[model samples]
Target: VGHTIESTVLALESIAATDNIAKNLGIEAGETIYYVKRIRYIDGKILCLEESYYRQSIVPYLNREIVEQSIFEYLETALQLNIGFSDMYMHVGKLSAESARHLGLTEGDPGLTIETVFHLTNGRPFDYSVITYHYEHSQFVVQANGLYL
Candidate 1:
């Protein structure tokens, strides 16, 4: 949580077809969607690989420049969309061949998987993502804070 890092875009484009299960939530089948993927690194060491799909119709102004920088920035500012809430689910998994390749690990290596769902201000699901964390290198801790009146 306190490290300088760099990001690299692995792929970013609009796809008319998607296999994402969240499509059924609102987006129509065969509808266009923005598929964004990137790798996060600290001092050149890969930390995680994140891949997300956004409903194009909901965030249609996205461009390559925005993708290379920050999609959330564009989503919140340029698009003027509010992120109502999000849900995260985490689990341990065996790294898939593709995920392993992206993280520079051998197949069958340990991986931490997290799936996230984001809802917009209108209460419509707008984004869904799957992130793979390098189990050997990742250090994640959650803290709890409560405010009382």
Candidate 2:
């Protein structure tokens, strides 16, 4: 028996504004934005929750299928956007009522929180995301090789 990671877009919408979304995306107040939320699963078991913010100015076209499938792939292949780098921050946080319900976990459950800001090759920030993963379903591994000269 074996399992594989699966993902599905739970919600995709174009909203005028949201709580702290503009702050995270570094856009002006009231600017148009797209909020994409999805859940990860492994063999029908909940793994983690990921929410991403995309600015309309950066990605002019937004659609459900683009998000439902793979935003990164669409950005690179379809949009031809160059991915420069990403800055990430990780910590522990409690899941909100809504998020916990979606993940089928107890409300206020502790989980690992990862925030990332992706920059384009042109040096402009394009996306900001926050991902939460429970301890039971997640692990962090770092591989190293070679020594300093």
Candidate 3:
């Protein structure tokens, strides 16, 4: 599980870096800059979330639009690893509270338990489902269901 989580993080970082470089080369909106804040692993899977930010002082020479898009494409492809939104949201929520107060979420926030499953189509929000899992004397313990919040 640790390896899986690390792989996901590295993949995301690589995509973001690639986009940044492409932007410097005038590629366009193929990539967007994001700061990874958290990663969580459970039941042989990993989840992560990142926040996007802009740096005006460090402008790239490439086409920002193309570079941003390219980055998005890269992430979307990597997500094919079968990662889920529930894990991402929970981990990110915790991370935001711990390391990104600017994100406006706090630890033990009830909202984290709600909205367990999220669906995406073409990188857009589609719908969501609730799920729960528990690991007893095992390596994972996660449990939730629809609309707890």
Candidate 4:
């Protein structure tokens, strides 16, 4: 699908990390982290809402300008960070009131949620994200190739 995609920054700030987020990133509680929230659009239609937290010590230069583009690209190219891997969990659940409002849906509407933790080449967790896709606009396609015995 060759369609245009856009990201609008809803929020970008540096804040103290919670215990859960700190644990996920292997950092101490109350450590500084960069929080980013964005609403995604595909062909000018709302598509998803994504929120992310990045370890400030690892990504010190994170800013709204950088996030409006691609953080992964910035990390890999500008910062010369080697992205290792990510652990992802996906599920279908009812949207919270805040998430629903952002997506123009009613509270408790069904939506797809994907949570991910991104790691660096040395296996240090760098970023964690939760993305909620609009139920009506969500489509996922995965392809695998391997040698058969």
Candidate 5:
């Protein structure tokens, strides 16, 4: 759980930095990109979600600073939780249409898939990914892509 939290933080930071660089290079509109991080707990397990958006342009003064600040606030809140999990159950990268179908995600739904890469100081780095499809705007169907370490 600790490793997951740490990796999540690093991943978000990297995304924020990348967004800044992209903005400076004019690859993405500075006001159109934003980062979102969400955390949930179920059955004594913690699940973290992070994504970088480039199409939503509904905010004023949208920049890397605002994005990083929001992430920092989220981490501050998550660090207060006590999670009890020794081993993870799912992790992987990329999602194809077939994979989504097998995972029960409908074809027409708006969904977000995350590919998480983790580097540890004493162990091999790994990629963890998840796909979430939402229906009815109330619930999401989740699928894990690879083995959890």
Candidate 6:
């Protein structure tokens, strides 16, 4: 038996980059970039809100149909980009009013926020994203391999 997982793309647009986003993506402020917002559900229950920004110079094109499928697959198979690694941060936070509404919770409800910056094999940052997970439904597992003293 397994739980069903689903994702809905809420917004997908091209917009001028902000300073912070520009810095994260190694692009200039006001450069065109693709922004995508989506929500993930498990077992028919909303679980997380995800927002991502991609460099237009690298990604070039995107559409609702493509985004609803898999951006990673397009980047790898079509663009031939090598996804190398990411830097991530996680923290406890209160959901914003918009996030709460999408998650079926009240504003200020507890949530887990994860921020990540993804890089290419050449160490160029191409995507930055933030994901907010519903506190009641979120679970995380980490596996470590190392020598313990």
Highest lDDT among the candidates is held by which one?
A: 4
Candidate lDDT scores, in order, read 0.80, 0.82, 0.31, 0.91, 0.35, 0.91
Per residue, candidate 1 scores C-alpha lDDT tens digits across 77-138 of 88889989777899897988999999999999999999988898778888888889987777
* Model 3 regions lying over 4 Å from their true place: 1-70, 74-96, 99-102, 113-149
Error of 3 at 23 (Å): 31
Model 2 regions more than 4 Å off:
1-3, 142-149
Candidate 5 RMSD computed on C-alpha atoms after optimal superposition onto the true structure: 16.4
Q: Could you give candidate 3's per-residue lDDT for residues 1-149 as a string of tens digits?
A: 34432212311222333554333323334444332323333334432222232221222222333233333344346434223343233321233254223223344432232223222332322122221111121244557776676
Poorly placed runs, candidate 4 (over 4 Å): 143-149
* Cα-based TM-score, every candidate: 0.83, 0.82, 0.19, 0.90, 0.24, 0.90
Which scores higher on TM-score, 3 or 4? 4
- What is candidate 1's CA lDDT for residue 6? 69
| Candidate 6, position 31, lDDT | 96
Instruction: Report residue 68 deviation for candidate 6 (angstroms).
Output: 1.0
lDDT by residue for model 4 (1-149), tens: 79888889999999999998898889999999999999988988889999999998889888878888778999999989999989989989899999999999999999999999999989999999999999998789855587565
Q: After superposition on all CA atoms, what RMSD does each candidate show versus the true structure?
A: 3.4, 3.6, 16.1, 2.5, 16.4, 2.3
What alpha-carbon RMSD in Å does predicted model 4 have with respect to the real structure?
2.5
Question: Which residue pairs in model 5 clash with each other?
Answer: 91-146, 92-128, 92-129
C-alpha lDDT of residue 55 in model 6: 97
List model 2 lDDT by residue over 27-105, tens digit each.
Answer: 8768888888899787777878888888888888868878766688899998899989888899887888877887788
Distance from true location, Cα of 14 in model 3, Å: 5.7
* Tens digits of per-residue lDDT for model 6, 21-124: 99899999999999999998888888789999999888999999888767899899999999999999898888889989988899998988999999999999
Q: In model 4, how many backbone clashes occur?
A: 0
Query: Cα deviation in Å at residue 119, candidate 4?
Result: 0.8
Candidate 1 segments whose C-alpha is farther than 4 A from its true place: 17-19, 22-25, 144-149
lDDT of 5 at 136: 24
